[model samples]
Target: MLPLKGLSVFDFSTLLPGPLASLILAEAGADVVKIERPSSGDEMRTYHPRVGENSANFVMLNRGKRSLCADLKQPEVVERVRALLERADVLIEQFRPGVMDRLGLGFEAIHAINPRLVYCSISGWGQTGPKASVAGHDLNYLAETGILGLSAGADGAPVLPPVLAADIAGGAFPAVMNIMFALRERDRTGKGTRLDISMADNLFTFHYWSIGSGTSGGGWPKPGAELVTGGSPRYHVYKTADSRYLAAAPVEERFWQRFCQIIGLPQELRDPEVDKKAAIAEVQRRIAERTAAYWCDVFAGQDVCCSIVTTLEEAMDDPHVIARGLFDHRVKSGSVALPALPVPVAPVFRSVAEVRAAPGLGDSNQELLGTI
Candidate 1:
């Protein structure tokens, strides 16, 4: 049996963070009932690239979950939702601080009805901060937390991240982890706790090395000055003759030596005493002399920790990724078949074949409401 076989989750969240957290729980065998709005449902359902009746984003995040449509403003509907909450083991929401309180489903109100509900609230700045009411997105949280400043380009301009790092890492992952911890604690005390997950506050955890150095009297690193950022030649992206890139991350001395030998670097330049700027330029020049494919072949099966920077499609079709069964599961969206987004649940707890397609808005309304 799955770890969360008998657990029930009432997910009153939309978009990415809260939905993704509930997705993990659903994959782990929790019975997740998504409580969406009456007609609009989750906002992500209307995103571009529709798969059948739902958007690709919504389908991927909401897989293996049932949905119940209800207008919380309606008195009867609120009672129906409250009934579900009484039996739910967890409740996840991503609204602003006072929105739930205004809706009459706040933590205090819900806890009174179900003491064992693990109530998780995901927001940008948390529930009790000066900026708590300020509206923000993933980039805003990264900027506010000083993480965006760490990712500046050579021109000293901050680069916008391609992915929603704050949403997934800062919000979803922490919510799931805390929910699991709260569940375990509930098992011991027979009561659940409220989890306030602030995306901005949580993002500082990713800056552990920088924070440690600064606290120890080493001043905070300037943009593009950190070893992993771009200061070191051994850990940067180098462009190839074909205009593609090669990621060289041989940080250890042994791997660095191997990489230098493979690139045919001069003995004097191999020493750390050489000018870092000059050394980095030399490495860049040498890498640009060959095509990405040539370097990929040279680094194949080597411990030099170098690789050709591949496109998303190429990475998905990589031999190792395919062998590991990373994209083995397919979910049917009407006539179209889409690959299932991977969840971190262990294979022993859930298999790819066991994953179900996302439910339509209000798909389980009749059945769920009847039970309530």
Candidate 2:
């Protein structure tokens, strides 16, 4: 049996964070019912590019879950949501601090009704802070937490990250982890708990090494100056003749020696201490002499920790990735099909056939609210 086979989740979150947390739960066999607004539903449903009737973004994040549309402003609709919460083991919501209280669905109010509900609130700042009420998105959170300062381009300006690090890593992952812990605690104490997940606060954990250095009086690194952040040639991206990139990270001496030999660097330049900038420039020049495919073939099956940078499409179709069955499971929305975005749930807890498309707005209203 799946780990969360019998548990029910009432999700009142809109975009990425809370929905992603609930998606992980659903993948592990929770019966997730999304509680969206009556008319427009989740704002993500309208995001482009469209997949059949809904946005591909929505379909990717919200697979294998049912939807219940309700106008929380109305007294009857508030009672309908409360009815679902009464039977739910978990409640996930992402709103500014006081919004839920204003809607009469805050943690204190819900905990009174169902003491066993694991109430999770995901926000940009947190439930309590001077800036908690301030509106922000992933980039804002990253900038506020100083993490964005580390990601700099050649011009020294912070570059936009390819992924929503704060939303997925800070918000979704932590929410699921805390929910699991809360569930375990409830098993023993017979009571639920509240979780305050702050995307901005959680991002500080990603700067572990930098924070440690600063705290120990070793000084925090400037942008693009850390060893792993482009300070060292052994751990950086190099462009090839074809204009594609190669990520080479042979940090250890043995791997570095092997990488130098494969790239045909001279013996003197192999030592990183032998004029580091000159060595990096030489390496970059040599790397640009060959096509990315040539380096890919040379680095295959080697322990040099070198690889050609791949686009999203190329990464998805990679041989090793395909062999691991990462994208083997697919869900559909009407006639359009897309791979079920993979979650971190253990393989033993999920099945390919269990994947389903995101439900239409209010698809489960009749079934979930009929008795109410």
Tell me the RMSD of model 1 versus the true structure. 1.1
User: Per-residue error at 1 for model 2, in Å?
Assistant: 1.5
C-alpha RMSD by candidate, in order = 1.1, 1.1
Q: Number of clashes in every candidate structure?
A: 0, 0
Candidate 2, superposed: residue stretches over 4 Å from native: none
Per-residue error (Å), model 1, residue 84:
1.1
Q: Which pairs clash (backbone N, Cα, C closer than 3 Å) in model 1?
A: none
**Model 1 residue 313 lDDT score:** 97
Give the TM-score comparing model 2 with the true structure, all chains together: 0.98
Runs of candidate 1 with Cα error greater than 4 angstroms are 351-355
- Cα TM-score per model: 0.98, 0.98
For residues 48-77, could you state the per-residue lDDT of candidate 1 as single tens digits? Answer: 899999899999998889999999998788
**CA lDDT of every candidate:** 0.90, 0.91
**What is the Cα-based lDDT of residue 69 in candidate 2?**
89
